[model samples]
Target chain A: MALNLFEDKGCPLDRQRFTWKELVQPPISKLDDDAFTRVRVILMNGMEMEAIRFSHGCARMNRKWQLPLAQLRIVEQHQATMINGLLGADHSILETTIAYEQVAIEVTAAVAQNEPDEYLAQVYRFGMLEDFDHLYRYSAMLDRLEGKDANNILQCYTDIVPGRPTIVEHRAPQDNLREHYDRLRAAPITKLHALTIMSSEQQTQNFYLNVAPLYADPVVRQLYTEIASIEEQHVTQYESIIDPKETWLEKWLLHEANEVYNYYSCVQQETNPRIKAIWERCLDYELGHLQVAMNMFKQYERRDPAEILPGDLPEPIKFESQREFVRRILNQEVDLRALGTQFVNKSQEGVESQQYRQHLNASGSPTDMVAAGYEWFAGTELARDGEITREKYTRGHKITH
Target chain B: MDKTTVLGKNRSGIDISPIDIKEMMALAKVTPASSSGDEQAIAQMRQEYIAGADVLGSVPLPSTLKGMASTAMEKLMGKSPEGFIDKLGCRLAFERTGVRLYDALITKCSAAPMGAHIPLDRLHEFRNEEFQHFKLVENVIRSIGADPTAQTPSADVDGVISLGLIQVLTDPRTSVAHCLEAMLTAELADNDGWRMLIMLAEKMGMEDMARDFQQALREEDEHLVSIRQWFKEMVIKDTVGT
Candidate 1:
């Protein structure tokens, strides 16, 4: 049965404030494997939804009612700190990073398969490979640094392989733009999907930006720098797909709805009782947020909230392994590139020449320097599938780096 | 133009660029289609969309009506909405079943006696993997512009599939071996379904999808093999009077 956020008894805005003690709650232990993935997903989803609100532009909200929105911004900042503070503990940042990539790989591939627009599907598939490669690169690091199989961390659900190599993921930002969806005509799910991914990629970028420098290992740091820049491109690529024409009120409504939907999903699927309680509480809190947004829509925009969202919500978003779904995309379009508003074959006319050099330079070589570390430690390159020899990379420059 | 110019000189310290106004006006012009007052009709239409989408192109339907409805939908929406919906529904339903099946299996295994060779941790590990698979599929469905709600057509079968596994829960005599036997049936079906999906995707010219399904196929193959081997060792070894 579906949970209705609108009908739920939610805390009023005045009552929603948290004390410092409540805000800085202890982090869920990293040892709780399931909770680890759930926490990362919730944080990532919140960040994504929050991005939509921050980027939203409202002339009407700006003209007469700037104070309330400004106040709301402060609350948003407070919530952000609270969310990030949950990860503030000295947890193994490496495993958290793995969970992030695992989420990216599975989510990106699922989006690719289910996206109604062929172009959007292609766009997602393009990024799926990059994120997939990141998972593989990080898995190698996990083995070398911690003497742990990435599978132990990854649970072997996501595959370790080369996506579009990170070396070539760097690009002149303007080249990342793709055609945008029509907010009025496009399905609401499409808008949410694009923004959700944009938010997730931006979070990944932010993560690597801060965490990369903290690492003393030069090679690992370099890999972070490489992938972080790629994430910036990913953010640009995914965000460009969102219709800039969406009104501030429209965007706000969708953002709140997304928060409610995601939290509801967590509440249903979360196995850990403690984490599930958090999801439930947050779902209620977000319902209050949605109510405020709904009132604002009615008072300012003079439209019924149901017009923006239906009387009932669509459905909860879910996270699942898209290993097969992603594999299908990898098999077909590992060679695709985004060119302005269109996705073109990598060999197409207007594609940049420098990118090809980056691809070629990195092609025969393993994407990560971990191979060298693995070789030095184990006397051979250690991979999830045992020792990596010339046979692995010699086959082709495309599938294996 | 600078931010001030586009935002109309930042009146009252609230930035409202001309570009922002321009963008908002464009959106206002293309405003979403207004909702009608017929709540029942809307709900019915939603049901129709889910049902039509779930079996679209895969099953025989009321031809004249269904074909006309689909054709009209195409002209209106610029695509066959049902086909994509059906595909997503199937993915979501299958993954959800995988999750639930694992949950039931784990519970049954943990409670049953005789940990002799079958490590409970191993069951927990597989269950965890299935949960990951569920999450991945769910994300894909959401990304593809659909909800992973069980109300969708293919998702409706989640209950049916879960019911098949309920025997492990209801019957006290059910062992990990019996659970494996039950799971083998599911694993085989999942394997075949994924294989068929790959073929369908390839035929549809979705090479990337074929690759994605192949990865899933590899995992499901492993799952099938593991379950078959376990069932023989844990259940069949004791039952056949050997």
Candidate 2:
């Protein structure tokens, strides 16, 4: 059933309140819970984080709207806390990192398939491949460092293989931009997809930046630094695709509708009953937020919210294995590179990005060093019980240091 | 679910995801590594950094007063006092962390559904001994006029190492056998830490401190034996249904 935007008034912002105990609910079981639950938790946290960020940005620009944005921002913060707090203490940082990459690969793959505009979809596929490679690098790190398997977190829903290699994912700032979708002509789902992925990548960028220094190992630290730089480029690339000409109120209305749409998607597919309820409550809250935004649109812009939003929410984002889609993209576009807002063949990649990457890798690429001839086995690389293939196997491998 | 170990939807293995694993292995085989070489590349990069890296940090001067610290260093030893001080600091930190590990283990045991005949009283006895050992180390550091609260480089490293053990003990999902193994790890390290302190104290001519450490080492030996035994018993019982 499609959710009608205007008919369902939802719980108003003032009524949307959470106690500390309510905010800090019991975490999902690391070993037993579905991996997609963690994916939803991570993605929604990204959503709430963006909500707070946009609210603060909007408040700074529109002085008269500061109070309403403040009210909305507080709710968003608690929502983020409640959602993110569900990731249990049992997850080591590296384990949680594997889950983060799963979100990047699986969720981005889903979005890439659904995006309406060909150029924007290409942008997503290009970025998705980069993040897919990141999953492989992080998986190898987890196996070698912590003596754990990434599949434990991934649950075999997403494959632990390389895609467009992270070393080649780096790009010059100018080369990273993509053409923005026309706000007037673009499908509502296209707008939501842009916001969702950009928010996700931005959260990943901040996550890598925040946790990078906590690592004791130099290579681990460098790997995070390198990936975090790519996530920054991803953010730049993703955000540039959102139409910049939308008015402040117009953008705010779209943000609310996107939140409602995402929570609706989560509510539709969430498997765990407790987590599903959380999604349902959040869905109602987002609809309420949409109402508030609608009122503001009327008062501030004197326009109907339907001008930017759909009468019915679009089909929910699919929460399933994107293995076949990802494998196809990997086979076809692994060599594609960004060239001035356009994806191009590896040979056609501009000299500027190539030179930038060379300088960065001058000391040796950590992503390369960490995953050298790395292969993911069921248990881990170490799970090859008694097999010893030394010296001869590593011969002719790349990267001297 | 009450059993610590069960055969269920343990999707982490190849059995449930045989098709996916096969596909993944095939893809990985065909895909060339992004960069090059082997694990040696990481070791080589790490070697360069390790060559240039500084030590963790310095031990605090006695009471953090420079003049008093110099005097305290003299009191602790006339020869190689920093080495002795660093090891003593390490012991102090480990003993303290050991108490907390026991606190977590006891809580986990009570909450555990299988709560096998774990000797809670004996666990208490062990926990108190750890606290006593911590107090002893604290007094020894103070007697040598070094600040017991100061974190030496060795202490910092011990903290980093104990993180995994603490994580295992405190986690609710870990079983009795799992936590017992974690406790065994702590006890084993704690035993060696005490023995090392005793050796260092004797080497530095601190006979009284050496004697104090010898007593702590004896208690730590008991802890190691008991944890190892319990871990063995639990794993065997869970596996063999004995």
Candidate 3:
């Protein structure tokens, strides 16, 4: 049964509590759990992080709402900790990176298909291809540098092929923006999709920035810097799709609703019962937050949240591999480029973007350098026959005292 | 922690999701790679970078005149003393890490069922030897008028290589046998490291230092055999279910 957003006032804000033990539980096994489990963990963590970020921004803008926003932000911060803490320590930075790209590709692909507006769906397809290319580049680094297969992290669920060359994903700030959806005419689902994807990309950009310097390899450090720039562009692209004219209260109501929608999706499809419980708890907590937001909306704007949110969520975002849809998009839109508020063919792309990318790649592209001549086999590239494993170095002069 | 590996929902392999693996492999076959080539291009690029690469770092030169005299004497007698001091720094860092690894092993071993046939005293002995070895290398580097504290390039690289061993040792979830396996890797490397250091010292005309390193090499040899035997016994006991 679908959760009724209006009547089901979930665990009240006062009763929502946590202990330190609850915040830092045992992480899921990287080898044993489904890749989608990590995907949900990463995405929901992004959702909670976005919630806290939005609440803080709201409090800063409106001094009257500071106390209530402070109350909500603390809970949201703990929720982010509990969700983000589910990733086990066994994941090396590069391995966790593979899972992140999987989230971007699969979640954005799912959102693209379920989107009702053709223009918005086209926007998602464009960004998804760039993230898709990042997966291939990171996978090559994992294989060549670490001698590990990305499919171990991907679990054969997501494709490890390129979508668009990341070398060209750099775009001018003007080229990155897109037309916003009309708040009144757009379906409730359109607003939810835009927020969900924007939150996810914003979190991805932040993640890459935080972990870029943690790498010891120079090329990998460069690669993170390169891919993180694209993620920043994606955040710009997706955030622009949200109606900027929407009231702060309206945006807050949608944020709470989107959190509920995402956790509900995770709960519906989560196979691991332990992780599923966390999602259910987060969902109930998000409902409580929604209730608070709804009351504030009525007091401030004198409008019903039903005007902004559907009575129920549209549907749980599908958490499975979107291989067919992704491959088709790769075939169709690999050459598509962004102009102001629109996607264009590569030839028709804005001159500003062309100069921007050319300057970015003036020295060289780390994505190209790291992934030059890279291919994916069932095992790592080392498994391929006729490949040089150790011969190229053994013939060098032996060091003798 | 469980003292053995038990079968659970281990889903990393292709076997757990047969249907999904087939679907994935089929799609992978139909989907072409973004660019067509092999790993040779990666190597060539790496070679180019290597050609243009900066050194990891420089060996710190002696500052005091007394220290300078010591370094000059060694250089006059043999090849450059910088490589020797760098390797000594590597050994010193590894032995320091070795002490910590043994401390972790002893703590976990002492926690094992209140004297459950795991030799805590032997781990203590090893831990002390590791500390002593660290001190010996420190004194050796200082004797050569080099900074004992500065992280040499070789030491930095060795730290990178031993990171996984530290992970295995410090993790509370790893069993005694698992730690022993990690210890075995450290011991085997330590033994080889001592033997090479001894030969290097002798070639550089330091017979007294070589003799001290020979004693350390013999202790490391004992560490290797004991850890290998314990690891084998633990695995066999788990396997035979006696």
The per-model DockQ list reads: 0.01, 0.59, 0.37
Error of 2 at A110 (Å): 1.6
Off by over 4 Å in 2: A383-401, B63-76, B112-116
Q: Would you list the clashing residue pairs of candidate 3?
A: none
lDDT of each: 0.61, 0.87, 0.87
The runs of at least 3 residues in candidate 3 whose Cα sits more than 4 Å from the true structure, single-residue gaps closed, are A386-401, B1-3, B63-81, B110-117, B139-147, B200-211, B239-242
Query: What are the models' TM-scores?
Result: 0.54, 0.92, 0.89
Candidate 2 per-residue lDDT, tens place, A1-401, comes to 89999999899998999999999898998877888999999999999999999999999999999998998889889999999999998888889899988998898899999988888888888999999999999998898888898989988888887888888888788998889999999999999999999999999999999999988899899999999999999999999999999999999998888889889999999989999999999999999998999999999888988899999999999988899999999989999998898888999999999999999988768898899988777778776542455444465354353
Per residue, candidate 1 scores C-alpha lDDT tens digits across A207-266 of 889898776445556667777777888888888898888777777777777767666766
True contacts kept of each: 0.00, 0.61, 0.43
RMSD of each candidate? Answer: 29.4, 4.9, 5.6
Interface RMSDs of the predictions, in order, are 26.9, 1.7, 2.1
Clashing pairs in 2: A397-B37, A398-B36, A398-B37
> Which candidate, 2 or 3, has the higher TM-score?
2
